[model samples]
Target: MNILYIVGEFPKLSQTFILNQITGLIDAGHHVTVLAKKSESNHKIHEDVSKYHLLDHVIYYDENGRDSKFFKGLTFIKSIFSFGYSQLLHKNHPIHLSWKVLLSSPNLILLYNRLKKEPLLDIDVVHAHFGPNGLLAHRLIQMGLIRGQLFTTFHGYDMLRFIKQKGDDVYTDLFQSKTVLLPISNFWKRKLEGMGANPARTIVHHMGIDVDKFEYHPIKMSQDIKIMSIARFVEKKGLIYGIQAVSKLIKKGYNITYSMIGGGPLEKEFRSMISNEGLEDHIRLLGWKTQEQVIEIMKESHVVLLPSVTSHDGDMEGIPVILMEAMAMGKIVVSTYHSGIPELIEHGVNGFLVEERNVDELVHTLADIFSLEDSISISKQARETVLNQYNIDKLNRRLIDTFERKTH
Candidate 1:
């Protein structure tokens, strides 16, 4: 089956799940194309991106328009006049044109010109990653610009803060037009249903990690425990709390080193906090590592700490893939009981969980893992958990099956 994925940005470091899914589908002998609003980051891209030659299959709408802006403008004007003339000729007949259709005419004109110049492949499924992308696909389809079965996946911000700001009616058109509404976690599935999404059409499909790439190695206990967090320095990640917790532990004369990997808006603030607390020696902020680098760092570290919390804007995680990557590497993880984290982690079984922003509990959990006799067992269990539930090969098969089934 031919699949076209619509996303806000292509080749992003943060949304590796999309890349994994695209590559997994291609490996399974399915043709997939990516249609993104923009391309991002001059930094190194994922290895699979080059291995599969994914850039060849990607279509950036803005980039295409930039090539012949004058021609596109002329075409846009011509299309509007042509459409208006047709409407006038059919004014005697009952013509139903909704406000949405009128509002989307400008974009439709641009899409019409783009398609005339370079047509897209025949698409069996139009899979959109976020709510806004789904809305864009709906508009294009409504204007007869594309043909496919619409499938929308709701991630963290799109379902939470986006809904809070735009209200429930924001997705009313998408919910009506979509063939399926996929949420990465059960928590999000329920939220979508509450917002009037058809329950039968809503499925909880997790974004998985490539387990083979992240080889499992039993964590060896060390006197100086290295705790690493591979997340953006954002409020929802609760990196500030992790820093404070580690600082308190360092004050108690514990031999611990905390390293944060990933860059974001909070980098300056985090650096200031680290300097103000005089944790320059114990804490290091290593910004943005590649997928290969992350695995190597995990091998050197004994624990992965991701203290995720619900942000002020209601943005939260939908079972972070980084946690799965750490678990797949046979590393003990300490994260919060927020969003869909509990679904992946069983307290004291596979990994440890603490209340969101609970510095005392986070510090306590880290101390417990440091001294626990059954640390090896916990690490093994964590690896097993990911292998069983969050493996990319297994999850991608399930996703393909869902896509193959016709949606009424």
Candidate 2:
């Protein structure tokens, strides 16, 4: 099958879940072409990105002149001359598109040109990873610029934060169209339905990790516990709560070393909190690392801490892939009961969970984990959970089956 993947950023280090699916499809003998407005100019990328030669199949479109009205007019005129007026003025190609589409994609002419060129023909499934990209791709398909059965995957921000900012009717047209809606979890499926997505078409499709890459390590008793967190320093991550819990554990005289990976807006704030609590010696902020580096760190660490919470602005998580990755590797994951996390983690069963932003509970959970003489059974269960459900190879086959079923 020929697949077209529409995304905001290409080759992003954090969104390895999407990359896993793309590479999995290619490994299964399906051709995939990635379309993005701009490329991610990162120095480090996941190994599979280069291993699969994914950059060779990537096509970038222009996002240069969407803000200014004068520039928009110039691009519109340029598009007419470059691609001919007949295609632009087609019945499905509305001259007066929604303000959002027109404003965001003023250079649609550039996208049409790139997609129509060689090596991008016969799109069987248009798999868009976010709401905005789906919206844009829906417009292109309507204009007869691309051909496929549109399928949009709603990951966190697109359903929660985006709807809060754009209102409930933001996806009305796309939902009403033949686009099949896929939310990463039941939590998101309900939210999408509440916001007017067709219940019959909306399905829960989780993002998965490459389980084979993360080797399981048995829990070994140690006096000094090594904990780690890999997340952007954002409000929804509730990273500050994790930091406070770590500090309290230190105060109780539990030898701990917490290493935080990734960087974002709240770095300075977290640094200040660490200094105020005198936890600078215990907690270290080790910025962004490549996928290989993260896996190596996970092998050394005993606990994976991710305390997620609903941000003040209505932002939430869509069942973080890091949690699944940790579970797949037989690590004791300590997260929260936020969003779709409970769907993935059953407290005291496969992994542990606490209330969102509860510092005391987090500290208690850590202490309990440390007190346990043997956690090998729970670790085994954690590894089994992901092996059965969150494995990328299995999920990709399921995704392809859905695509075939829908397209036929």
How much is the lDDT of residue 373 in candidate 2?
88
Candidate 2, lDDT over the whole model: 0.86
Clashes of 1: 0
Deviation from truth (RMSD, Å), model 2: 2.6
Give residue 286's lDDT in candidate 1 (0 to 100): 90
Give one digit per residue, the lDDT tens place, for model 2 in 164-243: 77777878899899999999999999988888889989888899999989999756748989999999999999899999
lDDT of 1 by residue, 1-408 (tens): 889999977888888999999999999999999988668754778888889999999887766434365765676667657556555355353322343454434445555555644555478888999887787777666555567888888887898887787677888977776568999999999888888999989999999999999988766767898989988788999999999999988888788888899989999999999999998988999988889988888888988999999998889998999999999988999899999999999999999999998999988888878788768788889999999999999999999999989533
Residue pairs whose backbone atoms clash in candidate 1: none
User: What is the lDDT for 116 in model 1?
Assistant: 44
TM-score of each: 0.91, 0.92
Please report, as a residue range, the 10-residue window in candidate 1 with the lowest summed lDDT: 91-100
